[model samples]
Target: MPVPADQAHPLTADVAIVGGGIIGLATAWRLTRAGLSAIVIDPSPGSGASLSAAGMIAPVSEMSYQHGRLFALMRDSAAEYPTFVAALEADAQTDVGYRETETLVCAADPADRQMLADLQHYQQAAGGEVEALTSRAARRLEPALSPSLSGAFHSAGDHQVNPRRITAALQTVLPAIIRRTAVELIETESSSGTAVTGVRLDDGRTITAPVTVLATGMTPTRAPLPDDVPLPLRPIRGEVLRTRLPSGLPPLLEHTIRGIVTGRPIYLVPRADGEIVIGATSREDNREGPSVEGVSQLLRDAQRLVPGIGECELTEVTARARPGTHDDAPYLGTVGTAGRGPISGLIVANGFYRHGILLTPLASRLAAQLVLRELDPPTVPESTDHPATADTDHHHLQTMNPRRIAHPAAENQPQGGRP
Candidate 1:
């Protein structure tokens, strides 16, 4: 039995993960599967930035210029997703809404078409599997698309999974979770050095562990850390909307529709149950709720790509902030010194930004390897086809090192801003 939140009893585990978003929960799941006891600490799981995400696993359509390392990590994660979701579903006895449907990148105007042509060229040069398509071919795949589209392209490898279902499955399979907020880190100092021993909850209970993973997203209530550990995380708010087609109607789209309408990007992700997820507008503000302007712009841009979007009923409007980093890449490595020496027992997995859902598999697997000190973890049954490549790329890990922005000597490293 679990101890009550009001009780002052302390718990022990192999790993104590802060934050219960998909990333946190999935990492915990990975650790538990590796024969280590782990616990997730959160006030409410799956109610943060992960809740509002459109869950696009399209590394091709989502690619940008000069983010080669990040793109490689994304592609590896997308490849491993099938194995990840299959094992999770079998273990939890629930579907995670994984779909292999292709993605269509549409251009709604002449300017948008030109921009897409350039992006496609960049994507092709980067070894991405994308094919140019005429507007007629795109409409044949997704008839709901507006006929006024100037051009389109096919990203056959890009796919998606429902974030809500994935989070719920992780919650089900993970054996331990503390339903409380982590207020602070419990550090222990010894002759060796200062190491994080565990975490202190808001209810005054401490969960002791040898390793503590800080997978906290963009929540304002995150625990305070020491001055030396520089996270440099910022919040990038996004607005997303969910809509349902009227009864007796088919899904408005088969493949996900990612489009640039009047130079602004929008996407429509249609679910099997006739629900289409549309979004989003990126803003660098501190607003806590959906804004009128953001919603109006999303609706307008989305309707321009798929004319049928205007007839759907809006079900939910979500506004949440994603944790972004200086280089737009996730901070995956452990916090360390100038020589990349890791601080004992402290591992960070944050600043995933917009790719949180898509990056979960690779992030979770890598975190588990770090915690267990395993160099060659066995691939899950279905993941054999796509071996774990990103975790082994030394250069990629260096670029994603959390200390890059913190260390004075490492400050000269190249920085890539958000696209």
Candidate 2:
């Protein structure tokens, strides 16, 4: 709900997060858990790219040759998911629909099989536990799979979560949320330099805080920031479909199916509630709405993998944009000036194209630490026993620096980014 305008003119908190998607809400939740007051501002919370995601935490299946840092980040985030969801559910008293099901990567034809083979070799070399499976062996594990599959691989480490459930859970535990658009950032000049005090909402209200976080996924919310603060982000739109199986029919799939059919990649994620999510068509034409051609292509490719999909009811079609960068990696750090180190109270946590859901737990924790200026912590092993140390966080932030426009491997890759 929108905060009533007459109630207050200037809201104050320890941190003001601009954008109420998974990143923003989860960051606020983390801040509150750390004994800090934080408020989230957005026009509609949880209705952006987070809602359109299939929520696959598939670090292995989605691995790319050029994105080694991203792969490590994804792997680490997925490992922390159990602890994150447990804490969130305990606080919210609701399930976030997290599933630990394995994923099956399939190939439609001979050419697709060759491509799958190449990916398997790379996955093995990168320390990903993947097994190349024969078509018969793959069908045995997933009986509903089409017998026409030429090749497949088993990724037992891959899993998924319900993005909507996650956002709802975070919303329940957060302290404050103003349902309004943040139109601009409020800056204050001090002896040190210019620092972000808070944000100016569209309703003529202001939110004042020492720290401000920009987690606005794919929304161009960075327009309010200074021109020198680098945020080279672009929108890559995707279309997804939802369907329900017939009442009498059994579940269509036991595991998530990710496949390539004639060079077009697609995935079908099955839920316990008899719902299957089929997607997605990645494009850059800037069509903000669902396209007929994209829908047709998804259904066709999904049917090629699971023929039973044709019998399901077409429940819904959705289109949303995922924030893309030149290297297809996220921009997660403080806003830096040309000569200055970092702005006093400005942090950026955006450009998470396809891995937003997978990266939520770590991203939120890192953002909260940045807000409290608690970047340094005692050194500890990589486990749930203790939070990540400054060494780990700094390494991640450096890899995702907003000012670094080009990646070392970006120009060498044929796609020029993550495929």
Q: For model 2, how does the per-residue alpha-carbon lDDT over 90-181 read when each residue is reduced to its tens digit?
A: 99999998999899999999999999899888888888899999989999999989999998999999999999999988988876788778
Tens-digit lDDT track of model 1 for 1-419:
32333343448887888999998999888877767878899888899999999899999999987887678888878988998998899989998889998899999998999999999999988889889999999999889888999999999999989999998888888777788889998877777566788898887778888888899988878876666677888889989999998999777789999999988999999887888999888899879899999999999999889999999999999999999998898887666554433456677889999999999988887777666652223322222334765335445556566777767454334221100
Global CA lDDT of candidate 1, please?
0.82
Sequence-dependent TM-score of model 2: 0.92
- lDDT of the structure predicted as candidate 2: 0.82
* Stretch of 10 with least lDDT, candidate 1: 374-383
Local lDDT at 236 for model 2: 89
Off by over 4 Å in 1: 1-10, 337-341, 374-386, 389-395, 408-419
Error of 1 at 59 (Å): 0.6
lDDT of each: 0.82, 0.82
TM-score of each: 0.92, 0.92
What is the number of backbone collisions in each predicted candidate, taken in the order shown? 0, 0
